[model samples]
Target chain A: MHIPDGYLGPTTCGFFYAVMLPIWAVASKIVKKTLKAKQVPMLAIGAAFSFVIMMFNVPIIGGSTGHAVGGVLVAILLGPWAACIAITVALVIQALLFGDGGITAFGANCFNLAFILPFVGYYIYQALTYRAPAISNRRVLAAGIAGYVGINIAALFTGVEFGLQPLLHHTAAGQALYCPYGLNVSVPAMAGEHLLIFGWVEAIVTALVIKFLQKQDTNGFPPKTCGNDTVGLNAETTNGRSL
Target chain B: MSFFKDSVFSDENASKNGFLQSLDPRIKTITFLLFLVQILLTRNIFILLCLYAVSVLLACFSKIRLGFFLKRTWVFIPLFSLFIAIPAIFSIFTPGEPLTTVKIAGLTLIITRPGLSGAALFIARVVTSVSFVVLLNITTKHFELLKVLRIFKIPQIFVMTLGMCYRYIFLFIGIIENTHLAVKSRVGIKIRPKKGQRIVASNITSLWQRSYQLNEDVYQAMLSRGYNGEPLVLNNFKAGWQDWLWLLCALTIFITIR
Candidate 1:
């Protein structure tokens, strides 16, 4: 979900930027140490894929169409750190190139979509599929659950942020400075939508992609070490040295 | 998707000879960013409306369609802020002088004067801020905007990543469209949901493999040109007096509003 401008006050936006800057710094460092020349294009393509995936429209239960935010799917295919960078890039493009998201609220959007969504999704996927056969249906099930839980948690965080705005910043005459809805209204609106509708979309997308990945290349998900053969699919080509 | 085509339309506008298109990208970016911040700083409906009027004037000078701009900006305001601001319009959220009262069933809904103004101000701010962003994007080329970002000292790796990502997105878009068309052809009239999902999944897998192969070929090409991590581009940054004048005008407007 893209949080537009004027929804969050300057204080809240500044705080998120403070938190996100360090995380982005660490992400770049990790990405530099772990990735190499050949993988650079792969990372770029992954970022592009994350950006384009949102354009896919799927028919929901009500004959209405909606798209999934493929944050967790990227994390499952690549690592969580790379997913953070990819999603942050996608969010930036959306803000600058299109008017889809706000410029000041970019940090807050990344905090939800980049950090929380993918990290939670990746960990849950890892935890459930641990010691299980890589090609089994159980891994796909775990991915689905991870997708469900990950988006729900991120949605919860967004709801809390929206709810906190009115409480923290308001006029002396009891007028809200930023977001008008308090926790009472904001929490239910955001969390309910994600829990019932968006979460399932995410879960279904993640599981389908993971299943396809498993069938195509069984060794794609559990990427570990930094060499030509261990990064991801077609490992033989990723021979660029990573320091 | 119409959303994809929207960018194509904006790109066409970016190349047009117009007031905003002629300005330096760095100047346009900074001025728009300042305008966005000023828009966010106020909760006054009048001032917000004034800012929106100025943006509309600028859009006119930029030669973009005003109806399309208004349609894009207004459609989102109702969908997003309307729901959030609905509770604010009632006395339950922010109590004030009751403008009107209606009784439905057992409950009374009191529309408050201050609550109405508060919701109006919030929606106004959102509208004004988004308009500035829309104006900037529809006017400036994407690469020019990225180069302006580089001037701001954003990390090289991040900028590089974005550049590469921007190039590859078009390729992936084609692949996705082709795959969908192929699936539609094979499945005939009515499509099965399960089979559609499988095709989408498989397309993603093949896309990944193709990206990896493309990466190898691209990397080798770069190496042949003696490429390292840092790609050196010829920097020909020259800011004309018009750029400074635009910045001064933007600041004057901000100060007058403040």
Candidate 2:
């Protein structure tokens, strides 16, 4: 979920940015080492794919539609560290260019969607599928569950962030300076919707895409090793070239 | 799709020979960040309103249509922030001196004074911040904005990735548009929900495959052209006296407000 400006106090925004700075640094280092010279094109294409994935609205109940974040899917294909960088780049473009998210809140949004979502989703899928063949039904199921749990976790973090605002920032008279909802309201409101509707959308999209890619028997669809190898890039450069 | 294409892909407003358009994008970006910082720090509603008015005036001076800018900024407020703000005005959430009372079938609701003021302040902050951000975006070319990231010492590779991503997003969007049209033409706009999801998933896979292929091709192309891993960027940002004057004025306003 994209957090807009003014929803969180400046302190909260600053805190997230401080937290994300190291994570971003680590991610870039890992991606650079893993993908090397190929990191540029691979990450660029991944970021573009991540950006455009949000545009595909899938039909839901009652003729409504929802879009998938595709963070987990990207992680499955490109590894979590690369997914983190790709999604962060996409979020940056969204904030700076389209105004889809707030510039002030960029760090918070990336922490949730870029960091938490992909890392949690990828690991969960890894644990579930552990050593299973890539084409197995279990892998598909793992992806679905991973998507659902990943998004719900990210949403929970967002809720906690929003809920904390009232307690953290307020006037002398107890008037909220930012988001007014306490944990009781924000948690349920955010996590509940995702749990019921958006989570299922994410799950279905992830599972179906995984199934399709598996059916196509695409080589290196899900890299055997996560951060250790670059999967979808040129094979010769997979060992990574020296800068 | 048209809305996405228009709002994002079209840089007509940025290309216009307007005030913000003429300034160095790096300078404009920094000044806008200053405006956002001021907007975030202030709790005073009057100050928020003043900042908002200044954003509006900036938009006008930048040759942005007042109606278009207002609609673009306010539309997000209602969708993202208003729902939260609405409950903030009620006595249940923001307990304080009652400003007004409302009665429904069997209940009385008290809108607290503090609640109203807090809600108004939150709305003002959101609007002002969104205005400045929207203003900055609409008045600066997307590539220029990407280049401005270099000012923060973001790694050149990361910035280059971002630039390439921006360059290809439109191409993917076009592919998505064509795919949607092809799907609609065949499915006649009434595909079953499961089928619709299947189509979407397939399209996503198709796009990912295409991107993967293109990634290899582009990397090979880069290698052939002597890319050598380090991307060189043309630094053409020239901040004139007017840009410095604007920065000085912005800094002064920021300090004065503080």
Candidate 3:
């Protein structure tokens, strides 16, 4: 899901950056107002956790191993707004320090993974688990479904972004200067792999994690009520220093 | 593990007494961004080649091993760019004047000239952009790069949070490595997929619990040390005449190419 530099046209890159700027600003404001002084360490630790989550490779079929992005899981634990900041921080480190993604396409990557994935996944999980018991199996199932749907949606958006490049930035001779594949090709190629393989990986990981947390910390199982309240913030405020 | 350590934690190259290391990091970062913009805008292969060569030369000047740098940048080229470019070169993607025709099992395939040129241009853009990005990363310390974010008017707290994230990532990496080793020792390498997923989920929960605890402790420590939401940093970034000259030269080159 990490788009490298030179894959998207300058105009496309600029467009995403413009779109993400306000989203990032609002997320920052919400986190800071809610977490206060605890925001710094909480967000930093969350981002670090997000970064390391990608390193754990789970067994797949035929001896293959795949890693989960863990975006939805983080959103389930923290609020979607906080997850947005955490994932964005991790992406910045990846792009600037490790070159895993592109500097120019950083905004685009963040829009997909940080904003779209977490917000969509959290809302889906919230809607499914509305008024359910804290430690019920229904919540776990909701998490699994949310993870599946969220990542697939993000993948579809990525495919559309790639598919639009040729239509938006081709030369006069009809030769694509950036990504050559049209929507017909890029969409299926991106969405197909996630739909078949990665979506399951994300779902299982998310469900299992929720199960484990339920067993370990039953009181903290459903951290926030399904409402306008930010995820994890109410719990943190009640505990008075526990992020 | 070693790759993670080397890529994220290693700063030997950044600390070296090299040309790039002597310049202010903020200046280096801005100039690199300009170079990237130029790389994205230009369509000429010669201009792309020149930018790539400049990146290579800069890497050499920064005391980075040419072999290591080349391997780092080129490895990504095929993985990310070449596969797409290869498909674009066939007549199926970019249909135009035929350059070479291949017949396979009663099917005729044509490689068009326009297709080849488009693919070449795409590859060139990828190479040049990747080279500059790698060069900037390898030559700049990670914290300095994080600090550079402040120039964009990013909040000081956010920058500090990013710096802390960089600091703790290695700690979590160590924890992950130890956990992986323990799992390998106990279960061997051939666990069932379901078991592996369970183990990963357990580990993730454990890590989260640890991080949550650490967050409280660190916050208390900070409060004790007069950290009032705004973290302070040592501002040692002084851009001298040489830095300005380098900036001027970069801008001039970009303008000339344009």
Q: Which candidate's lDDT is highest?
A: 2
For each candidate in turn, the TM-score is 0.91, 0.95, 0.95
Each model's fnat? Answer: 0.56, 0.78, 0.68
TM-score, structure 1 vs. true? 0.91
For each candidate, give the interface RMSD after superposing the true interface residues on Cα. Answer: 2.3, 1.3, 1.7
Error of 3 at A152 (Å): 0.8
Clashes of each: 0, 0, 0
- Per residue, candidate 2 scores C-alpha lDDT tens digits across B113-190 of 889988888888888888899899899988889999999998665798898999889889888889988877877858
Q: Score candidate 3 by lDDT.
A: 0.83
Give each model's whole-structure lDDT. Answer: 0.79, 0.85, 0.83
Candidate 3 lDDT over residue span B1-258, tens digit each: 887798668888889888898999999999999999998888788898889999999999889999998888888653668876887887998898889988878988898887888888888888888888888888888789898999989865567779999988988988888988998898876778888889999999888877776876898999999998778987878999999999999999989999
Clashing pairs in 1: none
Better of 2 and 3 by DockQ: 2
Per-residue lDDT of model 1, residues A1-243, tens digit only: 889988888888889999999999988887877677666766787788899878777556755556788898888766788889989998988887766777888889999999999899988877887666656798789889999999999999999999998788877777777888889988998999999888988888889877776666633333432233323322111223210
Model 3 chain A: weakest 10-residue lDDT segment is: A234-243
Best-first order by DockQ: 2, 3, 1
Ranking by TM-score: 2, 3, 1
